[model samples]
Target: MLELVVHPRVSARHPQLSDEDVRVAWQNSFFQALRTGSKNSPEYLWIGIDGKGREIEMVGVPTATGYLIYHANTPLSKRVRDEVKGRRT
Candidate 1:
């Protein structure tokens, strides 16, 4: 099981999402890639569907024990969605 540690800032930034929503998104991730231009620790970007069936974009960094999710939001940009779709094909 992948342990997910959601940062407190996530709620502040996206109050509409709950911990459960974040968990669901992680579990259902369809696209994930290591973010480019990271300075320190490696950061990852993920796109997944939540329990509500809403597409969510998540950003996080891997920790010693698990992933620390620092950001999550819905309605991903068309460019990003298209990029992911292109990669899938």
Candidate 2:
């Protein structure tokens, strides 16, 4: 499996998702994107992925350096918030 390449911006903004979460999310998203990604776009391999519980949203954009996945959001709560940042309660 290829190592997940998460953008620094994603890490800084969404601390709820650890590096491991990023890895799993990327893998699941990438594979699913492959089945559903559009190939006609001019941009380099642009794709989008979302976690099952809607915890995070990702958008993959190709760059000269390499592939980069940016997490748009890391939602930690709904009508309620808790001390355990990683879990949804």
Candidate 3:
């Protein structure tokens, strides 16, 4: 099984991120990124939702099995989160 790994830096934003949160976000981001990936295509910045509907942003690199996670509390993540928060989804 592919172990869902979390980087320590993710704590730079939301200190409340549990292992379970990153795991679920990783799984959701990984599969969704794969579905959108293609040969010769550029990388994608993915926006996915967690079980409770909090938005998660991750970078999808070519040939990568995992994503670079940004818990909604980080500077960059928080900015994106705030920007999208007001929009109807």
Q: Give TM per candidate.
A: 0.83, 0.46, 0.44
Give stretches of model 2 more than 4 Å off: 1-3, 30-54, 63-66, 76-89
> Considering only N, C-alpha and C atoms within 3 Å, which residue pairs clash in candidate 2?
none
Q: Highest TM-score: give the candidate number.
A: 1
Compared with the true structure, what per-residue lDDT tens digits does model 2 show for residues 1-89? Answer: 34457777777877776656665655554322321333533223222234444444455655566556664455533321232222323
Model 1 lDDT per residue over 40-82, tens place: 3598889999989999888899987889998888778676678
For model 3, residues 6-28, the per-residue Cα lDDT tens digits are 55666555676655665666566
Between candidates 2 and 3, the one scoring higher on lDDT is: 3
Best of the candidates, lDDT: 1
List lDDT for all candidates, in order.
Answer: 0.85, 0.48, 0.50
Which is the winner by TM-score between candidate 1 and candidate 2? 1
Candidate 3: stretches off by over 4 Å: 30-44, 60-89
Q: Output candidate 2 Cα RMSD.
A: 10.1
